[model samples]
Target: MLFAIVSITMLSCGTSRNLDIERGTGYNFQAGHPEYRTTVFGYMDEEEGTLLEIGAKIVKGSLIYKDEDDTLQARISVEYQVQDLDNNNNVIISEQSTEIIKSTDQDISSTRETLDLNYTHPIDPGRYEVVVNVTDLNTNKNITQSIETAIPETQKGEYSLSNVLLDGKIVGEGGWEPISTYDVKSKVDSLRFVFQVISPQTDKRMEINTRLLRYASDTSYTRPMHYSNYSPSSIEYKGLDYDEETELQSNRRVLTDYASTFIEFKFANQERGNYRFEVRAQRDGDEEELFKARDFGVKSKNYPAVRSARELARPLVYLMGEDDHEELMKISNNDSLKKEVDRFWLKNVGNANEARHVIEMYYERVEEANKQFSNFKEGWKTDLGMIYVLFGRPWYTRSHLKELVWFYSYNHSDPEYSYYFNQPKLKNKFFPFYHYLLRRNNYYYTVQYMQRQLWLTGQILTRQI
Candidate 1:
């Protein structure tokens, strides 16, 4: 199981605040061969007034493929139900499910793929609960996750802004790839934000000031800073002061014979953490008034506390390389350790929070190994402990009378290999503990691949199962 999302779009409302806010519950489940893991991420949004939008992003390569009409097919279904929270007695606003099936003309090699889904329904502005169900049709296994979201009452008689949307890849006109979860990982295509501005008048130009701020918990990143993710040929947003040549990152056009417009901005290569986007609108030559402000998060709950710079170095032992590990182990003071740890992850991972995410998750696996396999020494110091710490939870595990087998996905193109371990001495104090016998060819490649894959989504990525 894994999490996937990478896009940002803006939305706003006029007199009333349009918070397309939805909390992600990090829910996931699977069915079928345990080795074949599939995970789903999704969320709900209120697009134009009363227009509800639900989106999901799925990442998996272990789908069951079967021959169908001379072609191998993999099919999955997604079901969603939106109910009025105020009245739960079967007062359903919308309910339906869609099947997403991918097939190949030949035997599937690796089903590794990324797919997106969007569902829309009309409902009045109010509170609602959305339940999403994902099922692997081939295996008949499924999981459900639910969230609460609302569409505020529309405001009139004042300049209004639409809801802010966090979107992924843009496909076509009015097509936005919904960012199913705020828990973002990896450098993706681009973060796109879309906003709509409406005023009572017509053909009137407005100056929209936009600011982006990065935050760590309650602390702000030393005021707002501007960065561009656009190509050199694209127009950039500097400060205020506009000429015809100056184009703010906005969609300025006439709509419904009134002054209605949508502002959009795209950013690239941002690290994980909380972010705030501030948009202010003003009539030409008038004082700028704050139109809409909201805070968005690009982080996972997995490493919530490590965002602080002071407590940084504590997890270094679990993630550092051999030479770096030796040097870090020699640090005698907490102050110096924090400095070294901060420097290491910042330089290597390019973001302090990203570095903490990597360290926390790796050490999390290490601690799990300790609790599950402790013996003469700490579990992390034992062979079985080492494998668990580095390779993470095995996709498949089988235990026999005196032996255990762990299978891990190495090359997606080929079947995964197995790690065989057995208890050599039944009388030993650690009675049932098994030891890895280097009897098979060296598993260095498998270990390397496993660790790298973990880091791929761990360093700047989201939670995985």
Candidate 2:
């Protein structure tokens, strides 16, 4: 049965499980693929709040063959979480499975647990304790028992159908950790997609679906498509399988908001050079395609994955802050973004915690947008709000000046703002303010805002008052 979400729903943490069945390590592989191994990361049990939320990023590494290593590799979940597990084993649990979010931002750590898992139940964290159970689907025997962890666990990102190397170049960088790169035919329009299929080294002939796709040239770089196979720019991933049984990446959907799901990425100046990448979803199990091989790396910098844009806004089991973002995207790339984001703020607040006035002020501007320009769109997306956010407030006496002139003094710690008007026959020579005025990424403030600043500093260029 298809578990398609008909609409958007945000399941806040400490809530109820949205699905019917909630047990299984969420190992990524064909339902009955023999070689696939299932591994669980951490265990937890609580007896306090009626809500027990277990959240972390996760990933499915290649299927593990028993006896190859001595690491714990199985996860077990109860069917009716938040509810009391019957003292008698009478609760009928359904077969459990998992899906992988294809187009996820890679994490800084190179591990299989890139995605996070969160479970909120009617049962409080202080109620019945959780016991970890394990069973090898291959051996059909209880192999181990795990103790529930009391504290929250951090998760790594996951990857899917991203292992295959087109001509040895990875088209998709799977899971946040261990970023395996791929090569493509073109750098200009190299479309990237994260598919549901397993690694090419698997014997499972099942076709996996795609969840999202991104265009390298797009402003945000990521395009959201919950789950659909049809596409004008779709590509199929297929290759040789090593017939290994390893747990796959996690594809949990605690919420479905695009802004809440996607991560914001910056180009990490890398030694291996730059390659634009994007992700797209697949149609279904029956759809197929043929791709040619290509080389992806000549001499590249070694960079790993990190958190997505959404994770930064709302933290999971752990609160990842601005400093965390700095480390995650810091990749094997450059240091520009990190320094710039900091300098942008440091110019005003030498110390943030001791001075939170600006942080409060920035959001106030956002709230203004929410109210004033909320017609058919949001204020953040409006021309006025964009400028407001970029430049605090405009200067001088003109809201719509015929022509605006801005000046900056980099060395002397001085900046200036001015406006000029020269219209011979027009009553309003002003070019309808906010016309094509888009936020130019990072800026100190607007012309009017600078004017206000100068007025406060007593550096009015064209005024004596």
Candidate 3:
């Protein structure tokens, strides 16, 4: 199966003494100056039980450089691992890379380095997790991301489609660089999607139908309280089928056996946000035999500033009680909402500085979510956003092909609390949104505690006072 997982951690700590420095653990935001940010993209082949290809992009501007013989260079140490949670067997990989940056006459410049890391491991088929860690050795800045994946047993002599690969302007030159997540400023006019079909059933004709749509998080239609629809006509691609005799079928490209072929897509003034691309392989009139999807975001160069108090307080909706929530909804204006917000926090936390600290911490997380977790809509509205706003950073996280597991605990030795989120289709269209099964009684307590401690970091607030 094709898997594209982009992992991020939003955590906080109380004091320097309480810092728990794990190889793959770090805060989503820092009170200090900005630091280097890394973006990762990848897919795992479960059938092979090994094919894992990951692509990473590090923006040069985000890094801090040191002077070395008139040359400015930044050194970073990277550690990545894939673990079988069931067996506790993991393959840990680490490396170091240096990027030499050139000083420009101007104060700032745009320079980035892209890395491709590929690995293969043979193991029993089951649930597995992968983690990626990057640290700036110069400043000891660390960032970690992880995901959970499912690898199916590889079948022999079967016609199968490879995972969709995101490419630069060139076709096969950029070896399977998956675009797991991205922003609008990084958008290019021409991009290629490459994959392969192995051991085709030549006797039966097949057609690959592909559709692209932007997610719409506001419009609700289903039982799932958080579920939303996608915007139509924003981004659409209809795949065409061709027979060997015809050579070409309309605008669609024909599938070849064993070799990698690509479909070149052109962009026309697209919006910045999250988009979903789904490809289905089936006989002309038959149901879809193979279903696969890839979710990517068109990020803006800079996030819009949170202007009003209501905007800042919007993230707190998850922490409100039914009565407070009702009162909040009744307020029709941001000015009034601002007063209500101040009173709400002031009531819970009497000290003004302490209340400011709490409000700042919560909104900082909300801003980070908007930067990293945005999909079809704002990041705070997605399922991940809901959990992050309510529960803060997960103690630890696991990545899978179709599911993401988050673990939480008061301390490392305590019984770990877990949350399971999976990718499910709405109206047969695939999206990257994962729905958390927060139905457990324990989770309610966790939520309540997180809400109670909105002003505190690295600790839960059991009661408002």
Each prediction's whole-model lDDT (CA): 0.47, 0.27, 0.47
Kindly report the root-mean-square deviation of model 1 from the true structure over all alpha carbons: 18.5
Q: Give residue 181's error in model 1 in angstroms.
A: 2.7
CA RMSD (A), model 2: 22.1
Give me candidate 3's TM-score against the actual structure.
0.46
Name the candidate, 1 or 2, with the larger lDDT value.
Answer: 1
Per-candidate TM vs. native?
0.46, 0.21, 0.46
Q: State in Å the error of residue 131, model 1.
A: 1.3
The root-mean-square deviation over C-alpha atoms between each candidate and the true structure, in angstroms, is 18.5, 22.1, 13.9
> Which residue runs does candidate 3 get wrong by more than 4 Å?
1-51, 68-71, 84-87, 92-128, 149-154, 168-178, 200-202, 217-269, 272-274, 283-288, 299-465
lDDT of 1 by residue, 146-203 (tens): 6565554434534555545556552352444544443443224466666666565545
User: Residue-wise lDDT of candidate 3 within 12-32, one digit each (tens)?
Assistant: 211221111101121243422
Ranking by lDDT: 1, 3, 2
